[model samples]
Target chain A: MQKVVKSFGANTVLNALDLDIAKGEIVSLIGPSGSGKSTLLRCINLLEPIDDGEIWFGGIDISVPGYDPNPVRRRIGMVFQSYNLFPHMSVMENICLAPVRVLGRKANDTKAQALALLEQFGLADKAKSYPDQLSGGQQQRVAIVRALTIEPEVLLLDEITSALDPELVGEVLDAVRNLRNTGMTVVLATHEMSFAREISDTVCMLDGGVIIEKGSPESIFTNATNPRTRQFLSRVNSR
Target chain B: MIATVSTLAVAITLIVAIPKMPRWDRVKKSFFNGEVLGETFPKLLDAFVLDIKIFLWSVPIILFIAMLVAVTRNSRSPALFPLRILAVVYVDVMRGVPVLLWIYLIGFGVPGLGLERPWNSPLLWGTVALVLTYATYVSEVFRAGIESVHESQRAAARSLGLSNAQTMRHVVLPQAVRRVIPPLMNDMVSLQKDVALVSLIGPIEILRQAGIDKSKFASFTPYVGAAIIFLAITIPMTRTTDWLLERERRRTSGTRVS
Candidate 1:
């Protein structure tokens, strides 16, 4: 992604920004509130249309006007801060919805795949349960599974654990950790400092719609150069 | 209990006070004469069958058209702006015009065009008018449901690569329609009563039959009989609406979260 811009009315949420992601890399975006982390991820998933610049995923420039976004959106999945599960559906139904309805996959095969995934994630028993029947952690994990079922090339998680209870946060992050072990290309905006430090190969500190610093987690967390970076880290560390 | 005594007191007061009025005899002869009520009641009942027929035919058409208009107005696609505008116009105009005026315009206007056979039948045009007008009101009910669905649901579905139509069908409408069932039935009850509006144009329905009986017997008892028949159907429907609303409230309160 290069020189991407996004504005809502007069408020420019994402100024001219540039970034790149490598295959099989976990990139974590850490920022204060209103620092454009969520907007950046939403732009990558084409959920929010960028006002200017190029978003090249694989080889296609998806940010071009009139470019069909559905094709690109299909290859990049997103999990939101809110679980956003279809409350009317069972966990199994929510997982299989996109595959059957959008991708036109056969129901039996998809269900079998979904059951396998659920088994792997320790949610097999919850398949028949609706979202409201589960804890917040379980719901967010189901949301991740729903995104992953489509086999997207990249997973964009926008503050996925922000809504979880403190005790429940670890369970949801455990699922993301499992994705990292599989070498999934994941980009996430999160407030989980320790988890991001542990899992991310590249950590970018953003402020005011741009990444002010980007480096190995060891360098960024331990040997920060920017004063804003140091200030931000201290504020978070003190919390 | 105090409740029973109050009810008895009010009833007794009405009984005593009503007969003491100077014109009570004349009013009783006009509106409550048992002999006249007995004579006209059967004719009103027979004509009410026409009203029932109109209600039955109009219900499905109204629901289907309302769903279409609601969905049209709900769409965000720029390409569908024309259709969205037209839906707005339909909801505005149809709701703005009184249902009786619609019956006059369609029931009388269309047949005057010299369209042949069943096309010109007042029965058909009046039903059409009722369907068109009531659909707008019902469509607003559906729109309330559709909008009540959070924007996050759309974001979730679209983020999963579902197209707008697919998301609406597989995700949004199912939830929206579930939320709106109570309101939808409320509109149905209102439509059931409003079906009597067709009588003004031609159909010889309950209200029209009451008019006929009023002249024949030179008394007003048939109108009361007509009111009784309408209340008979509407009262049960109103209770059912209340029951549905309570059940929906319980289901959603227990299970649904943001």
Candidate 2:
């Protein structure tokens, strides 16, 4: 994606932000709250229309006015912090819904794939369970499964573990680790500093809608860095 | 035991006091006599069937129209601006006007416009007025339901490449409809009673049939019979609404495992 701008009324959440991720690379966006990490992910997914600038994905500039976002959105799956699963639908149905309806795939084929994903995620028994019936970690894992079922070119996760309990966070992070192992390109906004250091190919520290520092985790976390990045890391580490 | 005794005492007191009331004799002749009640019962019951028919047919159509209006009005698309305005106008006008006036305007006044047979039928016009009026109220309930769904659900669905309509149908509306079931049922109960207003337009429904019988027999028994019929249908529905609301509260209040 190119330099993207997004605003809500007077608040400019993303200000001419530019970032690029190559295929099979995992990029983690780390930032303080209101620092535009989530907004950046949303812009990349086209969930939020950019106020200015362009987002080019798969040879198409989706930021143009009147351009259909649905086709591109299908190629870029996103999961939310709140585990926004359809509470009324079962886990299996939730995973199969977009594949069957939006992709126009056969129901049996989609169901088979959904069940396979469920089995792979250790949620095979939960395929018949409603979201409300699942624990927070389980629900977040299901949310990721739902996004992954569409076989997106890039997966964007916005603080997927933010709402999970400390004990539950590991299970959800494990699922993300598995996704990365399959060579899936991923862009994520997160507070999981250690997890990002362990799995991310590159870490970008965003402050006030711009990437203040970008490098390998070892350099950013331990070695010399920009003063703001150091101060931010110290604040997070202290907590 | 005390509650039971208090209830029985109130009932016994009412029974004993009935004969001593100044209008007892006339009340007996007008509302209690077996002959008047028996004579009016079947006819009022028959007319009540008309009320039920109108209610049955109008409710589904009203709900369908109300869903359309609510969805349209909730849209933020600039392209749907005119449609949204029209929906807002329909809800406002229909809700602002009394059902009686609507029945009069549609049933009596519209015929003066030289409309043909179906349009001139009092039954059809009366049904139309009820549909127009109730659709507005039901649409407001539906709008509340739709708005109550969280924004994250929409974002989640849209992120998966579901179109706006698809998201609403699969993710948003099912949850919204479940949340609004009790309120919708409340509107339905009110609709059941409001159908009686259509009687003013000469459709010969329950209350109108009772009026005719009362004038012919010089008795009020037929009105009591009509009241009984309406109670039979509405009381159970009201109870069901309460039961549904209680169930929803319980389900929502249950603690989620962290």
Candidate 3:
């Protein structure tokens, strides 16, 4: 999202935010609550409309006013803070739902791929279990695989582990770390600074709906240029 | 009056206690003899036939009209608010009035208005009245079910590359229907009972047959017999409703377990 502006009535959540994520980079967005990190992620998939901006995914100008977003959204998979797995569907069905319905893939083909994804996430045993039957971390991991089953080019993670218990957070982050190894492009909105510094190729600090600082993980962690970034990091690291 | 009540009590007790009572056998013999009593059996059968005809014809038509009303009420188009208000008014008016009045109004009043001539057949008039009155109620039931699905589900579906209609058909409706099945079943049971109101229009339903037999015999046995048949049908339905409610509770609790 570049020069994107989104306001609810008069309160601007994203103002002239400019960002360019590379083809296969894991970029972590860190900020205090209500800093528009979530809104920025929402705009990339056009879940939330940007008042004035350009979002270019691959070669597609997704921000073209009045353009249909269904095709664009199909290529951009998003994981939510709440996991958002369909409770009525089993883990395997949740993974296969989009592929069979939207993509019109054969049932056998979708099932095979869904099972493989479940196995890859170490959730093969939970194929028949519904979302509510799984732990918070397990549900989040399944949610990630659910998005990936559609073969999206960009995966948006909106604080995917924030809703999990502290003990369960590691399992979800580990699943994400495994995805990072595959070189999938990821834009993560997160609060776990250690995980962010460890896995992210680049980190962007946002405050009051604008990017206040941006750099490599090492630079941002050890020597933040902005006083706000330093103070934010200090408080985060202390906890 | 006291003597009549005492006689009814003794007859009921004998019928209840003695499964093979000769008095019941005598009534059965008279019914099979193809005389006045014989007419009761065929009349009851005809009533059942009429009930089936009403259900088969009316349910689909009601469902189609209800679908249109539900979709209009839920959609965000320019006509949404007016459509919603119209549906609400329809439900309120139809539900508030007795079904019998609506039946009379549609059967007698519509043809008097110089609209298309009313259906000449009593069966047709009854079916039409049932469909018109129940469609409004069922439409509201459908609307409530559709609205019960969480808004977040819609958002999630939209983000998953589904169009607005697709989201409604696939994600929203399935979940909503699951949630509202018990209430919907209750409405259907009530509709089945309401079929008896067709007797008011001179169609020979079970109650009408019972009434004719009662007037001819000058006895209350036909009324008791009809009550027994109605109970036989509805008791199982009531049991099914209990089972459905329990199943839903279990499913919801299971979902919240983790």
Number of the top candidate by TM-score?
A: 2
Over the stretch B92-211, how does candidate 3's per-residue lDDT look in tens digits?
787788788888877666555655434465556766788878888887788888998877677677777878788888788877767777777777778777888878877787888888
> What value does the lDDT take at residue B107 in candidate 3?
63
Residue B217 lDDT in candidate 3: 72
Q: For candidate 2, give the docking quality class from DockQ.
A: medium
* True-structure RMSD, every candidate: 2.8, 2.7, 6.8
Q: What C-alpha lDDT, on a 0 to 100 scale, does residue B241 get in candidate 2?
A: 77
lDDT of 2 by residue, A10-76 (tens): 9988878888888889999998999999989888877888988888887778899888989998899
Ranking by TM-score: 2, 1, 3
Q: Please report the TM-score between candidate 2 and the true structure.
A: 0.93
Residues A163-187, candidate 3: write the lDDT tens digits. Answer: 7788867766677787877778899
Error of 3 at A74 (Å): 0.7
Please report, as a residue range, the 10-residue window in candidate 2 chain B with the lowest summed lDDT: B249-258
Mark the regions of model 2 whose C-alpha exceeds 4 Å error after superposition.
B1-29, B240-258
Estimate the lDDT of model 3: 0.81
What is the CAPRI rating of model 1's predicted complex? medium
Clash pairs for candidate 2: none
Weakest lDDT window of 10 consecutive positions for candidate 1 chain A: A167-176
